[model samples]
Target: MKEKKEKWYKRLEMPDAFVIIFSIVLLAAVLSYLIPAGTFVREEVDGVTRVIPGSYTYVESNPANVLDLFVSIQKGMIDTANIIFLILIVGGIVKIIEYTGAIDAGINVLIQKTKGRYMVLITLVALTFGILASMGLVANAVIAFVPIGIALARNLKLDAIIGVSMIYLGYYAGMVAGIFDPVVLVFAQTIAELPLFSGMTLRVFIFIGMILSVIIFTNRYAKKVKNDPSKSILGNRPFNDDEGITNIEPPKFTVLHGINLLIFVGYLGFFIWGAFTRSWGINELVGVFLMMGFTVGFVSRISPNKFVKIFIEGARGITYGALVVGLARAVVIILENSQILDTIVNATLVPLQAMPTYIGGLMLFVFNLLFNFLVTSGTGQAAIVMPLMVPITDVIGITRQTGVLAFILGDGITNIVAPTSGVLMAVLAVGGVKWTDWLKFVWPILLSWIVIGTLALLYALVTGYGPY
Candidate 1:
């Protein structure tokens, strides 16, 4: 047989997540040498450190050496250890739940009840994800739901993209709205000195716009795939069978399955309560998840030894994603160590400074859109950008609340596309989708989000959204 030549496009393959992130780190290191280092005078404000405007000064160049590049990776891992472990533990818990066959059974029942009306399922699931995220569901915590999303989609004859999108698309949708998002909205608003949740009316409208956009986009693609399997982005590509969700064997919905699912639902409700009332952090969240896993395992009658083995297997399966989060953090670490992060911020903002308030607000959205690739954490990005935005918004004739709106709108929508987002990478990893494949599937909806997000920022700016 003669060998066939590969297509040029096929040959121009994007590297895996690790390679892509590391390359960014390398680029950041190189930029450190080129972009002069700078700093801003920061002081404690309202119990948090914030950069003072007009305090930015050119600092001695502190280029990252080869040693710093390697060390930053270690530091990044340590810094994000809490998040990485939380993901691992959640993976294990999800694994334990899957072992109970409860999720599969529940998915089968859902599929049967829905009569394969995939759009309904997509809307409900995605909306649920979005709503919960709006109510302070941490982004990485979305991984806990990916298995159910993927399994539900697969069982319904939809592709993995539909499943993952149902979860993350809705998540980012709600996240972008920042209705009550503690990490994104709270941090941004507090730093911007806006009344917490004061501008929610506009945010609610933004949420509706975004979630509807997600549903319409997801439903369109799903309808095409359901009508023609060849339309799937994962066409002809086999899912990893080891994930267990890909090749679902529908199980009977037993009484135990019902009990387990109820427990799972209850756990989610409690999680939201804890987040809202108790202000539970990641460690607390992890503790509750562990409790849920064990409770499910006990109810399912899985023996201790088997539970241990399954937990390990689940954690092992998710190791790739957990590490990717830390790897992404390394890029930020490199930028910070090089002292060019502030320089990058200053350079980006200088252009926006000269624009009108409305235009500057839009430009701020664009800036955060690009900057999110460097600082993927919502709270982290707010910490860096919100302080600076407060002063700029003041001078630019926009309310601090308007700045917060722009910051979040720009921060969130691209999560589905940002390779530097550990939570996003982890979600993709869990869903068994490649970055390239996800990018191709997501670009259309992402464009829709961009339009919707742009309009939301303009509305905020025009309305002078604020209590300040």
Candidate 2:
């Protein structure tokens, strides 16, 4: 026992995303041997496929053999190929921007504009990110901009965590609020047959609460670091407070840099237009970002070969994150191939029918929280769980809108820690923050959010706040 305790694994080493995800895939394969296999019939709901209520059935065991387990990794990669490409493109674009020194020049201008009042800068940055993240289409797109937050933090003389938290938690808080999210909010409400964006007042309040919570939490940390640089967890490393650009003389805020930033803002407008009106998905986003890199590269006057070199370097840097996403998808594939995902869903949700209405609803939220580890995709979560949940809410004297609320709360909030989240892996990669460190920093606030989420769901249960 002593030797085991002393082992590095036992002492606790934070496994990187690849290890964590591959381990999950292995666990899913093992579960296939123990859990009964089942399937759910899916039907077209408003041109979208959805699981049919009351259509679950046990099937003959299809235990995932070794061959199937190995095959799943490749299949999983293929299934999420679009997301993988988008990740690579985002990495490339970020690198291209960096090569041009546009970020440093932009921050120089921002520093002059803000006049070192970091409270105003941090709050404004957090709110801007929160608003953008509230739009589901822009959420993943926001990952490419993580470096800017770090730059802003460095310029403000704060640590990396402070800058990242401003973007990560700020966006995440808005995401969990599910205010205008098409995937987790509208899609969930649609499955539950509630009006689009129903329960607006309560969610609006929750949204505000979330934004404020993130801002307050981030501000506190920023202050701690400001008061004593030694207080930052990241200070333990070969910490450089200069953010790598402090030595650049004269703080070059050239007109060319302004045009480059303007071009970026214009591209953001185009990108937002595409996401909203064109129903742009991963491929469209990849194309837009790739082109944006080229446009900005030329505007910043980087030579073609050098631009390509830096862009490739950036994309190469995030290969691990992209791979993590594909590997994480393997967990779903193994479970689906073995038919245990449906079985697990059935096993978890079927029991809610027997519990008291409020207790059942709360457990439903709990189940979604735990299940998010497996189905990390918000749209995928809504598809699999909503069919199970919407019908239960109807039969259990709970409002369907309440059911949607519980689901978004559970699925959305857990994204930060769930190793399966592609954005989580990607951000962790680019931000250079270990997953363990991120968890340590956020868990207190995360726990508070969980408490808030529970209360919100309980209120929904008590008030039956719904138009349905």
lDDT of each: 0.81, 0.79
Off by over 4 Å in 2: 1-12, 135-137, 235-250
- Cα error of candidate 1 at position 7, Å: 7.4
**Taking the tens digit of each residue's C-alpha lDDT, what string does model 1 give over 364-403?**
8899999988887787788778878887888889888778
Clashing pairs in 2: none
The C-alpha TM-scores of every prediction are: 0.91, 0.91
Across 1-468, the per-residue lDDT of candidate 2 in tens digits comes to 777767955667667656766777888899999999999999886778788878999999999899888899899789878778877778788777766667778987778887877878889888987877776646666765677787777767776677778888888888888777776788888777778877877877787878888888888888887787778776554123234333344357778777777777777778778878887766777887878888998777788899888888878876776777777778888888888898888888988998899889999899999999888888888888898898798778898888888899889888888877877866766666666677778887778788888888888898887863
Model 1 residue 49 distance off true place after TM-score fit, in angstroms: 1.5
lDDT: worst 10-residue window of model 2: 238-247
